[model samples]
Target: MRIVEVYQSVQGEGLLTGTACVFVRASGCNLRCWFCDTPYASWRPEGVDLTIDEVVAKVEEWDCQHVVLTGGEPMLFSELIPLTQQLANRERHITIETAGTLYLPVACDLMSISPKLSSSAPALASNPHWHRRHQRERCRMDVIQRLVREYVYQLKFVVDRPADCQEIEEYLAALEDIDRERILLMPQGTHPDELADRTGWLAPYCQIKGYRFCPRKQFEWYGTVRGS
Candidate 1:
């Protein structure tokens, strides 16, 4: 598999925010979001190749119980099956961060599914290839539905504006048995100041909708640097 960087960092988003964990960020993505923070992993893939055993060995060095298999869509790799199994064998709590556009029968303690909304679509002028490809592959409702039903999950949506809230609501309404509490609405920003600016309205929106408001605590604690 194409391995980006493996490191120890506090879980920055979702229900386990602030929890110490090891992150295995896989390079390459099926869809490109306009605001992807880890462009090295997606916009222009970068990383060395590592076998499943080597990846597992790296995670073991952290001395942490929690592991996050994130991406540029980590689900894109087949090595995930063995990777998750190896972590489970060690009793490490596994969290798979995915775009929820694809699925693999990998084991996970928490399936962190971040479904892209219309707001995530890039403009036609901004690299037409990715713009078209991102929109085309962004949402796979069948995949999202199956993931939520099969795994201990959380549905995280990146909200940039109040209008995006309606789209989220509509999405949830269309899905069956989606737990309201499991829904996380995170402000779309990278920098601390940028996050703060959007949190003003987004936090309130989450409150009113009975959804959890997820802050990018990593941005506040570690700034917008690589490896958390």
Candidate 2:
């Protein structure tokens, strides 16, 4: 796998927030979101390539129970199947953070699916290719359905504006068997003030819509630094 940095950090988002965990960030993505916080992992992927054994050995270096297999999109790599299997065999709680656009029958304790919204696409004038590609590949209901059905999952959306709330509603209506409680609405920002501004309305919206309000605690804890 093309591996990025592997480090220890607390669960900064989702239901497992605040939990101590080790992060394995794979470098590369299938889609490009304009507001991507980890641009190094996605927009311009950077990292060394590592075999499954090397990756596993590095993960075992941390004395943590939870392991987050995150990425520019971890599902892009086929090596995850055996990598996750190895982690699971060692009894580490495995969480795979993906965009939910791809599927892999890997061992995952939590399938943290963050489906990109239409607004996540880069502007057409700025990057026409990625804008069209992002729109085309962002949503995959079939992939989402299979992921949710196969694993314990959470659907997280990054809300940038009030209009996004309605889009999320329409999105959920189109999908089947989604647990609203497992749907998390997080503000789209890497800075504290930016997150705070969106949180004011986004938190209330999540409450009214019966979805979980997710905060980017990493920003608060580490201030948008890499390898948090």
Best by lDDT: 2
Give the per-residue lDDT digits (tens) of candidate 2, residues 1-228. 999899999998999999999999999999999999989999999999999999999998999999999989999999999999999999999999999999998999999999999999999999999999999999998999999899999999999989988888888888888888799999999888889999999988878878899999988989978898
Clashes of each: 0, 0
Candidate 1 Cα deviation (angstroms), residue 220: 0.3
lDDT of 1 by residue, 1-228 (tens): 999999998997889998999999999999888899999999889999999989988998889999999989899999899889988999999999999999899999999999999889878885788788888999899999999999999999998888898999888988998999899999999877778889999988878878999988888888878987
Q: Which ten contiguous residues of candidate 2 have the minimum total lDDT?
A: 202-211
Using TM-score as the measure, the top candidate is: 2
Model 1 TM-score, 2 decimals: 0.98
Per-residue lDDT, model 2, residue 8, is 95
* Candidate 1 Cα RMSD (Å): 0.9
Tell me the lDDT of model 1 at 20: 96
